[model samples]
Target: MNQVNTVVLLHTVLHCHFTSADSIENYLFEHYSASMKPRRNQNELVEIDIAMTIQTVLKVDERFQYISFYGWFEVQWRDEFLMWNETEYQGIKKISVPYQQMWVPDISMYYSEEHIHDLGVHPFVSVTSQGHVTWFPGAKYTVQCYLKVKKFPFDRQKCSIVVAAWQTTDRMQKLVPRARSVNEVKGIAENGEWEFQNFTYEENYDAEFDLTKIVYTLEFQRRYRYFLLCTIMPIVILSVLNSLTFLIPVESGERITYCLTLFLTFTVFLTLFDQTMPRNSIDVPYITVFVSFHLFLCVISTMVSILTISSKRGQECDSRDTQIVPLESQGEDLHLGEVNADGKRSGSSGKNYLRRTLKSILKEVFICKIDTVMLVMNFFFLGSSAFVLVICYIS
Candidate 1:
C-alpha cells in the first residue's frame, strides 16, 4: 500500500515546484512519527548499523575499576516513513536538519558504570532520499571493567564493553556492524599509565538473554617505565637493604635497631600500596609477595641479632664474676667456696649448671661472630625475592 502511494505521489507531485524549499522537509516529516517504528511494515525488522570511533582514552581508574573514553557512536538505520521522491524535492538528494524525534533503534551500553548518555552537538541527523539516516552522537562513556593488578605497574589488563539492545531482543531488531571490526582509528590521546595495545570485537548470540551482544575486548599494556622508576625501584632497593641488615655487627648493638626500622618502613609502604589497588582476593600481586617476604626476612634478622647480643652480654657477666671471685679465681676450690657462702649448695649448683647450659646453647647460634649466619640468611632471602620477581615477569 505504501509503495502504491509513493508511485502515485511521484507521478502527481514530482513536477510541482513548491513556493518554498522548506516544503520538502515539511512534506517528508508529515509522514514521520516519533513512537512508531519507521518500517514499511511493522513486522519487518529494522537493522541498525552500529560502529564506534574512539576519539581518545580519557582514563582507566584502577582503584575504582572503570574506564572512561571519549568517542562517537556511528549509528545508521533506515526510515521507511521518511522516504521521498527526490524529483519532488527540487533534486535534493539529502538533507541535514534537526532530529525530529524520529523513531531510532533502542540500542544501549550494557556495561555503563554510570548513566550519562547525552546527545552530541545539537542532535542533528542526515537523511538521504533513499530513507537512510546517519547519526554520529559522541559522549564521554564510562564503562565498569574489572582490572587485574597482580603484576602491578607492569600488568596488562583486559576490559570489555558490551553494546546490545537490552530492551529489544535480536528478534525485534538486528544490529549490523558498519565495518568489519572496531579499532582505535581516530587520533587517540596518549595515556601515561596504560598503553592502548589494540582491541577486538566479538559478536555472538547470547543464549541466556536470547540477544546478540557485541563485546569489544580492549587490551592495554601498562606503561611500566614510570612505575619502574618510582614504585618498583624503591621496592628493589629496600629488599636489598633488608638482606644487608644482618651484616651490621652485633658488637655495635645497632643491628636490632636496623632490622626494626626496615620492617616498619616496608609495612608502611605496603599499607600505602594497598590503597591504590582494587580490594579483591581473586589474585595476589607479586609485588605484595616480594615485599612480604622481605618483611619476614626482617623479623628473622631481628631474632638473630637479639640472640647474638644476649650471648655476648652473658659472656661479659661471667668475666666480671670471675674477676670478683677470689682475686681472679686463683684456685678453683676458692670459687666454689664463694658460690656456696649462703649455705644452699644444692640450689646454687643447680642454678649454675642451668645458666651454663643456656649459654652453651646460645654459643651454638653465634659460635664467635653471627655475621656468617646473617650473611647466609640474607643470601637465602635474596634468592627468594629474585624468584618472586621471576614469577612476576612470567605472569
Candidate 2:
C-alpha cells in the first residue's frame, strides 16, 4: 500500500489599512510579530501558499436541523523538484506548505447557535494559492453533493418525495428549487452514495462560481377535527330531538302544537344546514330526511284532528234526543197558549200522551247527539295526533 503524508496549515491576514497616524499600523505589526514569532522559523514566515483545492460532502436534514454529516478531501503541500534553483539561498531549505486538511470544529456543530434561521447549502470545491509566492494563479475547482433517500417519513401510497436544485446570486435573494431538466445531469445512485453524474467545471480565477442550494418538501392530506365537530354533532342532536316527539301523549291538548312546533324548528335547522352544505342533488343527508318526516307528521296530525272533530259532531247529532230532556217538564211552559185545552187535557190523561212523548224524544235526540259527536271528535283528533307523533319517533 502506498501512503501519502499530508500537512495542515493555518494562516491569518490583516484586512485593515491604516491611513490615520502610524499608531494603528505599528500596533498591527507588533501584534502580528508577537503572535507569529513563536511559530516562525528563521527571519521569515514559516507558512507558504500552494495551489490547494477543497471538496466537501455534507449531509444535512432538510426538515430538522438537529443533526448533520460532513466529509472533506485531504490536502497537503508537495515539494516540487523541478522548481529548484541554483546559488541563491539554495540549500534545499525546508519550505512551509500552506494547504491544510479541513476538520469539524466544536463551535460549528449546530447552526442554530449562530442565530441563523435560514440556511443556504451547497456542495462547493474551491482552489486557492497557498504559497506566499502565489504559484498557481487561476486554478479552478468543482464539487457536487447528491441526496439519497434512506427512509420515507410517510407511507408511499399517501405521498411522494421530490428533490430539486437551486442557485442563488446577488440579484436573486431566494429562488425556488426545481428538478434538474437535463437527464444526463441527474444524480446517480450507487451503493449508498448518490453522485452527480454529469457535473463539470472549468478552471477560472476571477469569475464567480455557481454556489447552489437544494431542498425537498413533503405534503399530505389530513382530516380536520373542527369540521367533524361542527357538522356531525348538530345533526345527531336534531335527530334525537325528532325522536323525542313520540314521547308526548295523545290526550294532551298541546299535541298538535308540539308537532307543528318541531316541524317549524326543523325547517329553520334545515335552512341553516343548507347554508353550510353545498347545493347539490346528491343523496339526501340523514338530517334532511328527519326534517321531511316531521313535516309529514304535522300534515297527518292536522288531518286527523279535523276528521276526529267531524266524526264527534256527527255522533252528537245522532244522540241529541237522548242527551236532552223535555222543556215542558220544568213547568214554566211559554207555549201554554199554543197547546189548546184539548192538548193539555190529553197531556194530563195518559191516553193521548204518545204524541207528546214522541216530540220529547225527538228533541232529546237532537241535543244529545250533538254533544256526543263533539266529545268523540275532540278525543279522536287528540288520539290521532299522538299516534302520528309516536310513529314518527319510532320510525
Candidate 3:
C-alpha cells in the first residue's frame, strides 16, 4: 500500500510540473529563507487568498453539537524574494517544493479544540517563476458548533466555522476570499442524516482586537423521513391511544388502566430521547414540549377516569337507599320512605334535610362529566400542540 501511494504521488508531481529540470527549483530555493513571510519590506502586508471546498460532510453530532468533514483548501500568496526570469532558468514555469521548506500563513480555525485529534497531512507546495505560491492540502476537520433544535427532526441548522490568522493583526496579514463564485463549497457527498444546503460567509474586522475573521456559515437540513419511523410515528400512535381512553365505557372498568398506560408510554419515550437532545437552555424542542403537554393530558384523563368510577359507585348506593328516597335525578328532592299513620315523618325534619344535602353534594361533585370535558380537552391540547410546533418551526 505504501509503495502504491509513493508511486501515485510521484506520478502526480510529474504530471503537474511537466519539466525534467530539478536543478532550477533547487537553485531558486537554496538561498531563500522559508521561516519568515515573503515580503520585500519589513512593514509590507502579505495578502493571503484562500478558497476552501468541502468534498464531503461525514457526520453531524447534534447531541454534542459538532461537525466532522473532509475538504481541501487552496491558499495563494506572492513572494517577492523567489521571483526570477524564466529565460535564466530554461523557461521553467513552476516547480514543487516541500511544504516544510516554505512559509505558510499562521492561520487556524477558531472553536477547533473540542476534539484533540489532528486530521491534517503535510503536502507539497507549488511555486511559479513569478513568485506565486499555491498550497493545496486535503484533510478532515471537526469543529465545535451549537444546535438549534426547536423543530428537531424537521429542523434546519445554521453552523459556522471561523478562520483567522492567529497571533497576527490585520495590518501584517490580510485574508481575502478567492472569488464570490468559489467561496462556497464546491460540492458535497451525501450524508445519511443531513442534506447539504448552500452556505454564506461574513468577513468582519474587529477594531478592539485588531483582528479580522472570516466566518463561513453552512446550513444543514435534517432528513426527517428517517425520523418518521423512529420518533414522529410513535408519538402519533401514543397520542391516538391517549385520546381513545375517554371513548371506553366506564362500566368496562378499563378506562383508568388504559389512560395510565398511555401516560407511562409518553414518560418512557421522553426518557429514551433525553440523551438525543442537545443540552441547550434557550431553544427547547417543540417535540419535547408537545410530548410533555400530552403527558399532562394523560394525567387529566386518568383523573377523569377515577372520578367516573367513583361517581358510578356512589350512584348505586344512592339508588338502593330506602330510609331517604331520592325522586329527582339531582337527589335534591327526597322524603321519608313512609310517613306514619299520624301523618308525620318518623325521623326529625333536620335529619332528613341533612341527608338531602349530603346526597346532593355527591351527585353534583362526581357527575361523570368526562364525555363532554374530554372531547373539548382533546381538541384543545391536540390543537395547541400543533400550534406550538408550527410556531416553533416557522420561527
Candidate 4:
C-alpha cells in the first residue's frame, strides 16, 4: 500500500512542477512530516554509518583529565520523502529540503563529561528524492578520559573518544563504521607537553546492554624539550650546586648557610611542581621521583658538612690541652715527685701515641680535605642522574 502511494505521488508531482517550484516544494512538505519517524517499518532497525573529520585538537588538560577538540560528525542514514525518480523530474534526482520539515536521528554523544547546553550548529542535509539522508554537524567537545602519567615528561599515553547512542537501542538502531575506517585529524596548535603519535578506531558491540559503541583512540608522546628545560634541567643544576658546597672551607663558616639556602630552593620547586600534576593519580610520575632523589642528596651533603666541621673543632681542643700540659710540666720543676703528682710518664707517652694514630686513621677513612670530598660527591651525583635519565627516556 505504501509503495502504491509512492507511485501515485510520483505521478502527481511530475506534472505539478510545471506550475512553479513552489508547487513541488508544497507537495514535498505535505508528503513528509517532521513528526513522522524516519524508519519505513517502525519495528525494524535503522543502521547509521558515522564518520568524523577533526579540524583541530584545542587542548588536553592533564589536571582535569579531559580532551577538547573541534570536529564535524557525519551521519548517513535513509529517509523516505527525500527520494525522487530522476526520469520523472527532468533529471532532478536530489533536492534541498528544510531540515525543520524532515525527521533526523536523535543521536547524541555518550560519556560526555562537560555539559554543552546549546543544541549545537545544525546544517542543511543533502537527500536523494528516494530517501538517502546525509547530515554533517559541527561540534566542539571536552571529553573525559583516563590518563597514564607515570613516566610524565617521557611517557606515551593512549586516550580515547567514546561515542554511543544516549537513548537509542540495538532494537531501534545500529551504529556502523565508515568505509574509510579511521579518518585523519589535525592537531592545529602544537602542545607544549604532548605530541600526537597515532590513532585507531574500534566498534564495540555489547550483548548484555544491547548497544553499539564507537571508540577513537589517540596516542600521544610527551614533548620532553619543554620539561627538560623548565623542570629537569633546573633540578639537575641545583643538585650539582649542592655538591659544590663541599668545596667551601670549614673555617669560613659559610658551608652551613649555603647548604640551607640550596635546600630551601628545592622545597620551592617541589611545591610548584605538585600544583601542575594530577593529585589523585595512582601511578606517581617518574619525574617527581627523580626530583625527590636529588633533594635527598642535597640533605645528605648538608649533614656531612656539619659533621666535618664539628670534628675539626674537637681536634683543635685536644691540641690546646696537650700544649698547656707541656708548659705546666716545665714550670713544676722536672722532678720525680712532680712526675708522680702529674700521674705516670708512661701514661702520657701512651696517650700521645694513641692520639696520633687516631688522627692518621680519621684522615684516611673520612675525607679530611673539602676539595677531595666534593670531587667524589660531584661524580656520584652526576652519574646517578644520567643513569636515571637514560632509563626514563628509553623506556
Candidate 5:
C-alpha cells in the first residue's frame, strides 16, 4: 500500500492538490485533468473553476401512474492553471471561478414523499486528486423541482400548492422543505386555468442553499354547481307558486289568505337572498327579478279582492227599492179617502200603483248594471295581471 500527501486551501474559491499513486487519484486526474492542473506560483496554489449546468426533464411515470421530474447535471472545470508550492509541489489555481451558491438549483413542487425518486447522485461538494481527496462537511446542493400549470380555475387567493422534498430511502414519506412562497403570474390564470407563477423562497433555514429530492401538490374549489342548485331551484319553485295564486276564486276567502301568505313567503325568501349576495344593484339577478314579479302579483291580487267586495256591496244597495208599495184591504177597497181640493185624489190606490211600478223597474236596472260592471272589471284586471305574471316568469 502507498501513502499520499494532500493539501487543501479553503476560501471563497476552494483549491486543493494531492501527491499520490492511488488508483482513485489516477481516475480523478484522467476525468478532470483538463480542468485541474499544476500552477506556476511558488506557494503551490492550484486554482480550479468548477461549474454545473443542470438539465431537467419531467415525465408522467407510466408504471407509478404519477408525475415525476428527472434532473441531470454535469460539473465541468474550465481555465485551469498550474503552479508550484514553496515545498516544491505542483498545484492548480485560478483567479475567477463560478460561485458555489449559483451551483445550487431548486425546484418548486406540491406533494410529499419521503424519498426522492430516481435521484442520480447524493448532494455533495467534491474535488479529487491522485489517491487523495478532501470532502467539505455539511456542504450541500439544492435543486428546485416545480410544475407550471397553465391555468388554474378559481380564485388565486384561495388556491394553494405545496412542495415536498423526499429521499429515496423512504418513498412513502415526504421530506419537508426549509421554505415556501407563492406569486401571481400576470396575464396567466385568466382563462379559467392555472398559470405557473414563480416559486417564492422562504427565510426558513430549511429552504436555503441546497439540492434535495421533492414533489409538488395542488388544491382548489369552485361554486358553480352549488349556485345552480341552491339559488336557481328555489327561485324557480317560488315563482311557480306565485303564479298559482290566480287559481283561487275571487269570492272565496282563501283568495286573500293565499295572496298574503305567498307575499310573506317571498319576503322571507328575499331576505335570505340578500344575505347570500353582496350588496350590488348593477342589474337585478334572475332570482331577484323573479321574486319582484311574484311580489307584484300578490299585491295586485289583494287589490282585486278589495275591489270585488266593494262592488258586491254596491250591487246589494242598488237592488233594494227606494219606495215601498202599500197593501190594499180586500173588503174596504171601495172606500177612498176624501179629497179636499177640486182635482186632488183622496185614495191611496193610485199612489201605491205608481210607486210599485216605477221603483221595481229602477231597482232591476240598477242591479243588472252593477253586476255586469263588477264582473267585467274582475275578469279584466285578473286576466291582465295573469298575463303579465306569465310574461315575467317566462322571461
Candidate 6:
C-alpha cells in the first residue's frame, strides 16, 4: 500500500495598508465638481430607483389634514464619477466618503406640505467599485392628504406618499424598479387606532407639468374596538335608558327628571366625542347623529311627562269646581226646603255626583291608554335605532 500526502495553501491580500486616504480623496475631488451631476449631458435621463420600508405611523392628524410616518428610504443610482479600477488599487473594491461631498439628486415628496425630518442614525454615504452610489435617508415624512371622515371611527382611509423630482421632470430623469426586496416593507409600530390593511404602487403622469410621479397608496382600516368600548356603547346605553322614561308613570314627576339627567349626560358624552374629531360641517358624522337622536328622545319624553302632570292638575281643578256647586245646593236645601223637597234634592245631587265621577274615571282610563301607546311606540323606536347602529358598525 502507498500513502499519498496533499497540501493546499490559501493566500489573503490586505489592500487597506497600501491605499492612502489622501489618494482616494484627491481622485474624488478631481473627478467630481460640486455642481456637476452624475449624468453626461443635461438631456441625459438619470435613472433612480426608490425602495422604502414603513417603520411607524407617528400620527394621522385629520384636523390638520396630514399624516406623519417614519420610513427607511433608499435611493440608488450609478455614479460614473466615483468609479475606480479594482486592479490598480491592490484589489481595493470600495471606499467610504462624506455624503456632503457628492451631488445627490433632489428627490422629494411632491405632496408633502412640510419639511421631512431625517434621523441621522446611519452613515449617509456609500461608494462601490462598480460606480454605484446609495443613499439611505431616514425618512420621517408628514404628508398632506384629504381624509373623508363621514364614518369616522369606523371609516377606512386611503393615503398616499408621492415621490418626484423637485426640479427635474420625466424628460430629464426616470424612476425604475427597486433593487431591494419590498416584501419586508411594512408598518412596524402600528397605531392602536388604525389597522394596516395593505398598500399599492402606482405611477402617475401630470400632463400640465409633464412630470412622472411615483405614488405609494397605503390603505388602512380604523380599529373601532376602542371607540365602541368608550364612546359608542355608552351612548347606546344612554339612549335605551332615556327611552325607559316613557315606562315610568307620568304622575310620579320623576319621569321628567330622569330624562333630563340622561339628556345632560348624553350631551357631556357628545362634547367629549367632538373633541376627538375634526369640526367640519361639510358632512355630519354618524356618531353625532346617534348622540343627537338620544337627546331628542329624552326631550320628547320630558315633554310627555310635563303634559301628563298638566292633565292631572286640570282634572283636579275640574273636580273641585264640580263639588262646589253640589255643596252649595245641599246647604241651600237644608235652610229652605221641607222634608219631601229636601229628600228629592238629596237624591238629585247624588245622581249628578255619580255621573260626574263616572265621566272623570272614563277620561283617566283614556289618558292611561294613550300613555301606554306612546310608551310602546318609543320603545320600538329605541330598539330599531339601536339595531340599525349595530348593523352599521359591524358592517
The root-mean-square deviation over C-alpha atoms between each candidate and the true structure, in angstroms, is 8.0, 21.9, 7.0, 8.5, 19.3, 7.1
In model 4, which residue pairs have backbone atoms overlapping below 3 Å? Answer: 82-129, 83-129, 83-130, 83-131, 84-129, 84-130
Model 4, 1-395: lDDT tens digits are 99999999998877666543444466667767786667667787788888766667787777678888777778888876555566655666666655667777666665565533322466577777677888787778777867777877777887777767766688888888685544363434456656776766799988777898888788878888888798878887887787677778778999889988888998888787687677774967777776777678778878888888777777767555443233124453432221333454433444555566588578545656655766597668767876976787677
Best-first order by lDDT? 3, 1, 6, 4, 5, 2
Expressed as tens digits, the lDDT of each residue in 1-395 for candidate 1 is 99999998987665554432467678877766788888768888788888776678888888788999877788898888777787776787777767756776777787686543332333788888898999887787899999988888778899888788767777678888766433463246677777887766778788787777778788888998988898788888888888787667667878888889999989987897788877778867788878888888888888877877887788777655542222233444323223443433322243455566586666756646577867777988798778868876885
Stretches > 4 Å off in candidate 2:
1-252, 313-395
Number of the top lDDT candidate: 3
User: What TM-score goes with each of the models?
Assistant: 0.83, 0.25, 0.80, 0.76, 0.31, 0.80
Using TM-score as the measure, the top candidate is 1
Per-residue lDDT for 275-296 in model 6, tens only?
A: 7667778756777878888788
lDDT score, candidate 3, position 12: 80
Please report, as a residue range, the 10-residue window in candidate 6 with the lowest summed lDDT: 4-13
lDDT accuracy of residue 162 in candidate 4: 73
Kindly report which residue stretches of model 1 are placed more than 4 angstroms away from their true locations once superposed.
1-21, 116-122, 180-186, 321-369
What lDDT is reached at residue 31 by model 1? 60
Give a tens-digit lDDT track for model 2, residues 1-395. 12322221111112111221123223223433322221223342222211111122233232222212222212222222112232232222223222221111111111222212212222221222221122221111112212221111110111111111123231322122223345422222221322322332222221253322222221122232453466435544544544444344433545457657666766776686565433444434444554456456455545554454455455555455332222243344322112342343212433235555675566556444643553454345445544654464344
Q: Give candidate 4's error at residue 231 in angstroms.
A: 3.1
Q: Decide which is better by TM-score, 2 or 5.
A: 5
- Per-residue CA lDDT of model 3 for 10-46, tens digit only, reads 9987764555346666676788787777997958999
Residue 72, candidate 5: how far off, in angstroms? Answer: 27
TM-score of 2: 0.25
Task: Give the lDDT of residue 326 in candidate 2.
Answer: 28
Flag regions of model 5 displaced more than 4 Å: 1-231, 317-395
